[model samples]
Target chain A: MSPFLLLLRLRLMEVFRVRFTGFFFLGLPLLFFALVGVIFSSGHPFAHRRVVMVATAADENRSSEMLVAMARFTEIRVERAATHEAAMGKLRAQIVNAVVEPLSDGSGYRLIVGGFDELFGRGLVTALPGHVELAVAPLERWGFVHYAFAGMLVFCVAISGLFGMGYNMVRYRQNLFLRKLSTTRLSKSTFVAAQIAGRGIWSLVQVLLLLALAHLLFSLPLSLVAALWTLGLTVLGLCAFLGIGFLLACFIRTEGLIYDAISSIAWPIVLLSEFFFPADELPSPLRFAAAALPSTQLVRLLRAVLLYGETDVASLLPGIAIILVWIVMTFTMGRFFFRWND
Target chain B: MGFGDQDALLLKVVIAAARLTKRFGSVVALENVSFQIEGPQLICILGPNGAGKTTLLDLLEGLSQPDAGEIRLFGTPLSARRYPRERVGVVLQKEFILDGITVGEYAELFATIQGVKGAQQILSQARLQDRAKTPLSKISNGESQRLFIAAAAVHHPELLFLDEPTAHLDPGAKLEVGRLLTEMSSEHTVVMTTHDLREADTLSDHVLFLVDGKLKAEGAPATLIDSIPPAARGHGTLEEAFFHFCAARLTARGDIEPVRP
Candidate 1:
C-alpha cells in the first residue's frame, strides 16, 4: 500500500482499538440522544402548572370539573383566591406561584402567572384557558431533545476530532512514535494528512449512523438534503475541532493535562452556548460570547437545517465564515507551535 | 598513502560533523564537537549523566539541528532535501511502545513506512517471532527492547544511532542485545551511548569520551588508556583513565587544586 494509505489505515485501526475513543467519540452521543430524546418526548398534560389560584364562582359548583382536574397534579398547590387583585397580590408576595381566573364564557379557567419569568410562569401561561381538556403536546416539532440532539451531534464531531486526531498526536509524541516516524522517509505532512483523513472518514460514519438511528427511533425528519447538510457541517466541525485539539496538543505535555485542558475549554463553550437550554435569556455580553464560539455556530447551523428544514445556503454564510476563520486560525497556531519532541 | 587508499578512505567516511554547537536556553548541550565515523564499526559514546551524549545522537540522526554547525551523511549535507533517511535508524533511551499494537504489526508499520519488506526477517533476527502476535503491553521489557532493535534495523539502515539502548535492560538482556548489535556492526555503522564502561569495552571498536558537553577524548580504548598518567593507572584500570580526563579539565580550569606528593 501507499505510505499515506497505510498510515490512514493504521490510524483508524488504532482508534477502533482504543476503548475510550469508541465509547466517548462515537457511542456516547447516540446514548445521550436516546436518553434525552425519551425524557423530552414524554411530556405531561399538567406539567405546565406547579402552583395556581382558583377564582371560584359565587355558586362554586360551576367549575367543579376544572377544579378537580387541577387537583389531579400532585406537584401543584391550588387554592381559592377571591379576586384578580388578591391573586396578583399573592403572586407579588411570592405566596402563590400563579393565578387561575375563571373565564366569563365558561370555556375554561384562564391562567394568570404574574412576572412571567420562571419556567413555572411560562408553563402556566402555555396551558391556560383549556386546563380541563388540554393535553400536553406529544412532541414539539422542534422540541428540547431536537435541540439537544443537534448539539450532541456537533459535540460528537468535536470529541472525535480532538481525541481521535489531536490526542493521538500527543500520545505519539510522548511515546516517541513521532520521532521514530520522523527518521523514516515518511513526510510529516503526509502523516498529518493521514490523521485528518482517518478522522474525517470516521466522522462521516458517525453522521450516517446517528441520522439513521434518529430517523428510525424518534422519527426525526431525516431527508437526503438533511443528511447532506449534516455531513458537510460535520466535516467542517471536525476541521475546526481538530485544529483546536492540535493547538492544545502542541503545548500540553502530559496525557492528564490534555484531558483537563480540553474539558475546561469544551465544556464551558458548550454550556455557555445554550446547548442544554436557551441562551437567549442570558446576559447580552455572555450571549454574544456564546454566539462567537465555533461550536455554537455549528449547533445553530445544524439545528436550522435539521429542525426547520432551512435550505438557504446564503443564510448560513456567517456561521460558515466563523467556523472557517476558527479553522484557519487554529490550524496556523497548531502548525506554528508544533514541536516533534515536545 | 596511495590515491586508491585515499579514495577508499573517502568512500568509507559515512558520517562527518564539524564544530557542532547546540544549546538549550542557558545551558550548553554540545559545544564545538566534531567527529567522523567510517563504515562497519561500533562506536560507543561514553559520558556522565547530562553529558550531552543523547543530544549528540539526536543531532546525528537528524532528530534535531545544531545551533551552528554542519553534518554530512553519505557525503551529502544534512540540510539537503535528499539527505539519506532510509539509510539511518535510531533507538531512543526510553522504551517507546505503540501500546495496542502487536510486535509483528509494529514491525510491519515501520517496514511499510521505510518501504522495506523485511518485517518477518527482522523479528526473527531479534528472536521475537514467537512473541510477534503478542500485544506490546503484554511483552517483557527485554522483548520490547529487542523489538526496538528489530524495528530500527528492519530496513537494514547503513548507520544506526542508539541512545542508551541497553541501560535499563537486565544483564542477560543487555548481553543478548550486545550480541545482536555486535553482529549488526559487521555491516552497519552503530553508534550508542552507555554509562557502563565494561559494556563499552565489550561492544565498541572506537570510543568517543565526553564530559560536560565537550569531547574530552576520542580513539580506540587502548589509545585513551595510553593517555592516562602512569601514576593514575595504579588507582584502577579504565575507570581511572576516564576520571583522569575529567579531573584534567577541572584542574585546568582551576576548580580544584592539584594534590602534592
Candidate 2:
C-alpha cells in the first residue's frame, strides 16, 4: 500500500475505534433530522388565530349578519350579549377575537376589539370595509423546527471539533505520539492529509446515517442528489472545524489547557452563530461576528440545500467562500504552530 | 590525515556537524559544537540533564534545524526544507502510540516506511515476535523501546540515532537492548545519548561526552577512564571517570552547581 493510504487507513480506524466518535458523526445528525421532521409535521394549532364572535340586543339580525361575515373571514365562535355592558364584559375577558356592537340608529355597527386573538382581528379589519379599523397585537410565526435543526447541526460540528480533532491531537501530543511520528519518514503534510481524510470519511458516514433515518422515520424530503450535496457540505464543514481544532491543539501544551481553550472557542461559536434564530433578528454586532464563523455559514448552507432546495452555484457562493477561507486559515495555522518538541 | 584529505579518509561519514549552535532567544542550548561519525560504529553520547543532549539529537535526527551551523549527511548538506530519509534512522526519546495499531502492525508500518520487505524478520530481530498481536499500549515499556529500534533498523539504514533508548527498561531488558544495539552496529552506525555511563561503557565503541553543550571529551571508554585523576578513577568504571571530569570542568569555570542528580 502507498504511505498516504496506509496512514489514512490507520487514522480512519482510529476514528472508528472511539464509540462516542461514531455518535458525534452519525447519531447526533440522525437525531437532529428526526426531531426536525417530527416538529415540522406536527403543526401547532395556536399558529392560526380563531375568529371572535360579538352579540348585542339592539339589532340581533345585524349582529348575527356581522358574525357570519367575520366567520367567513376568520375562525369565529359566536356568542350572545344582552346589552353593550355585556359585550364590554366579554371584550374585557378576551372571550372572542372582536365584538360587533349595533348602533341605536341601526344604520351601521361598531366592532369592539379584544386582545384574545390579534391575528384574527387584523384579518377581520382588512377584509371588512374602511369603516372597520384593526387594533392588532402583533404575533410572530413560530419557526422552532428550523431553529432546532440548525442548533443541532451547530452542536454536531462543535462536538466533532472538540472531541474528534482537538482532544485527540492533545492526547497524542501528551503521549509523545506526535514526536515519535515526527521521527519517521512521514512528512507533516502527509500526516495532516491522513487526518483530514479520516475525519472526512467519518463525517460522510454520519451524514448518510442521518439522511437515512430522516427519510425512514421522520419523512424528511431528502432527495438522492440533495443527500449527496449535504454529505459533501458536511464533510467540508467537518474538515474546516477539525482544522481549527488542530490549530488550537498546537498552541496549548497540556491536555487541560487544550480542553479549556477548545471549549471556550467552541461554545461561543455555538451561541453567537445564531443557529437557534434567524440572523436578521440577532443583535447587529452579533450577526456580523457570526457571519465570520464557519458554523454559521455551514448551518446556512445546510438549511438552504436541505430545507429550501437551493442548489445553484450562485446561491452557494458565500457559504462556500467562507468555508474555504476557514479551511485555509486553520490549516496554515495548524502547520505553522504545530511542534514536536514540547 | 591532513585536513585536506579528511573527506578521502572517511568511508561514508553519514553525519558531520560544524560550528552548530542553537539559542532559544538568549539561553544557549548548544554553542559552536562540532562532531562527525562515520558509518558502521556504535557511538554513545553521555551528558547530564540540561546538557543540550536532546537539542543535538534533534538536529541530527532531522526533527529540527539549528540556528547557525552546517550539517552534512551522506555527503549532502542538511536543512529543514529537505529531509533525506534513506540514510538515517532515529528512535526519538518518546514512544509514538500510533492509535488503532497493534505491535506487529506498527512494526510492519515502520518496515514499509524503511522500504523493507519481510517485516516478520525485523520483528524477530527485535525479539518482539511473540508480542506481535499485542496492542502498542499493551506492550511493556522495554518491549516498546525494542519495537522502536526494530522499526528504525528495518530498512538497514546507514546511521541510526536513538535518544535514551533504555530509560524505561529494567536491568534485564536494558542488557537485551544493549546486545541488540551492539549487534546492529556491525552493519549500521548507531548514535545514542544516555545518562547511564555503564550502558555507554558496555555498548559503545567510542564515547562523546558533553559538558554544558560543549564536547568535553571523546575517546574509547577505557582510555578515557585511565586518563582521569588517579584518586578519582576507580576499577575502570566510566561513571567514576565521568564525575571526575564534570567536577574538574565545573571548578575550571568557577561555578559551584552540583552535577545533575
Candidate 3:
C-alpha cells in the first residue's frame, strides 16, 4: 500500500477509536438537520402578536369595522370595552397589539398599540384606512429554521475541525507517532496530504449523514449538481479548518493552551461569521469581519447549494476562492511552523 | 539474483554522518560530528542528558536536519526525496497509544507501513504473539516498548536507531530488549543511545562517548575502560572509567581559573 494510504487508514482508525466521537460525527448533524426541518416546516414559533381595538362613543361603528378588517390580516382576537380605561387595562395586561378608538367625528378611527406589540400594530396601520392611527410596540424578530441551520452548521464545523485536528495532532506528537513518522522517508508534503485526505473523507461521511437526515425528515430537495458541490465545498472547508487546527497544535506546546486557543478562535468565528443572519443585518465592523471569515464563505456556499440549488461554479467562484485561499494559507503555515522532533 | 562481496559492504554502511551539526536557537546541540557504521556492529552512543546523543540519533534517523552537514545511507544522501520509508526503522523513547487498536492490529499496521511480509513472525519474535489480540491500552509498559521495537524492525530495515529504548523497562525486559538488539545487529546496522553505562558496557561492540556536544572518545568498551588513569580504575568497571574521564575534564577546567589563588 502507498504510504499516504497507510497513514490515512491509521488516522481514520484513530478518529473512530474515540467512542462518543463516532456518535457525534454521525448523530449530532442528523439531530440538527431534523430539528431544522421540523421547525422551519412549521413557522417561527416565538413571533406571536396581539392587536386590540377600542371604540370611542361617537365612532363606534367605524371602529368596529376597522377592528374586523385588522383581524382578517392577523391572528388578532378582539376585546370590546365600554370605556377607554378598560381598553388601557387590556393593553397593560399584554393581551393586545393595538386598541382601536373610533374618532368622535365618525370619519376615522384611532388605534392604540401595546408597548410590546410592534408587528401587529404595524400590520394593522399599514393594512387599514388612511385616517387610522396606530401606536406600535417595538418588534423583536425571532430567528427561523434557516437561521438556526446556519448557526448549527458553523458550530458543527468549528467543533469538529478544532477538537478533531487539535486533539489528534497533539496525541500523535505526545505519543511520538509523528516523531516516528518523521524518521521515515515519507515527505512532509505526503504526510500533510494524507492528513487532509483523511479529514476530507471523514467529513464526507458527516455530510452524507446530515444530507440523508435532511432528505428523510426535512424534505430537503437535492439537486445532483448542487449536492455534489456542497459535498466538495464541505470537504474543502474541512481541509482548511483542519489545517488551522494542525497549525494550532504545532505552535501551542500544552494541551490546555491548545484547548483554550481552539475554543477562543471557534466561539468568535461562530458569533461573527454571519452564519445565522445576513452580514448587512449585523453591526458594521462585525459584518466586515464576518465577510472575511472562511466560515462565512462556507455557510454561504452550502446554503446556496442546499437551499437554492445553485450549482454553477461561476456563482460559487468567490466562496470557493476564499476557502481555497484559506486552505493554502493554513497548510503552508502549518508546514512552515511544524517541528518534527520537539 | 546474486551480489558481489563489494555489493554486500555497500549495503552494510546503513548510516553515514559527515560533519553533522545541529543548533537550537544559538545552543549547539551537535557540532562537527561525523560517524559511520556497518551492519553487524552494535554501536552505543554514550552521553549525559545534554551531550547531543539524542540529537545525533535524530539526525541519523531523519527526524531532524543538520544545520551544516550531510548524512549518507547506502552511498546515497539520506533525505525524504531519496530514501524510501521501508529502508529505515526507528524506536522512540515514549510508547504510542494505539487507542482501540489491538496489539495485533498495531503490529499489522506497522507491518503495512514497513511494507513487509510475515507480520505474525515478527510479533512472535518480539514475544508478543500471545497478547496480539489484546488492546494496546491493556499491555504492560515493557510490552509496549517491545511492540514499538517489533513495529520498527518488522520491515527489517537496513539501519535502526533506538533512542533510550530500555529506559522505562524492568531489568528482565531490558535484557530481553538487549538480546533482541544483539540479534538485529546481525542483519541491520544498529545505532542506539543511552545514559545507562551498564547497558552500554553489556550491549555495545563500539562505544561512542559524547561530551558537551562533541565526540570525546570511541573504542571497544574494554579498550576505553583500560585507557583510563590507573588511580581511577576500580573493579575495572566501564561506568567508573566514564565518570573518571568526565570528572577529570571538569576538574582540569576548574583549575585554569584559579591560578592566582
Fnat, one value per model = 0.78, 0.72, 0.59
Question: How should the candidates be ordered by DockQ, best one leading?
Answer: 1, 2, 3
**lDDT, residue A161, model 2:** 59
Please tell me which model should have the higher DockQ, number 2 or number 3: 2
lDDT of each: 0.74, 0.72, 0.70
For model 3 the local lDDT of residue A322 reads 87
Clashing pairs in 3: A50-A97, A51-A97, A52-A98, A53-A100, A54-A100
Off by over 4 Å in 3: A1-143, A211-229, B1-34, B67-72, B75-86, B225-237, B240-261
lDDT of each residue in B109-156, candidate 3, tens digit only: 777656667579668877899998899899887788778887888877
Please write out the lDDT profile of model 2 over residues A205-229, one tens digit for every residue: 7767766765566555567777777
Give i-RMS (Å) per prediction.
1.5, 2.2, 2.2
Query: In terms of lDDT, which candidate is stronger, 1 or 2?
Result: 1
Compose the digit string of candidate 1's lDDT tens values, residues B175-200: 99999899999999999998777788
TM-score of 3: 0.68
lDDT of 3 at A304: 60
Model 1: per-residue lDDT, tens digit, A83-189?
55545434443334566666677766655554443456556556433543222212333344555778789888878878876688888888888877777788766
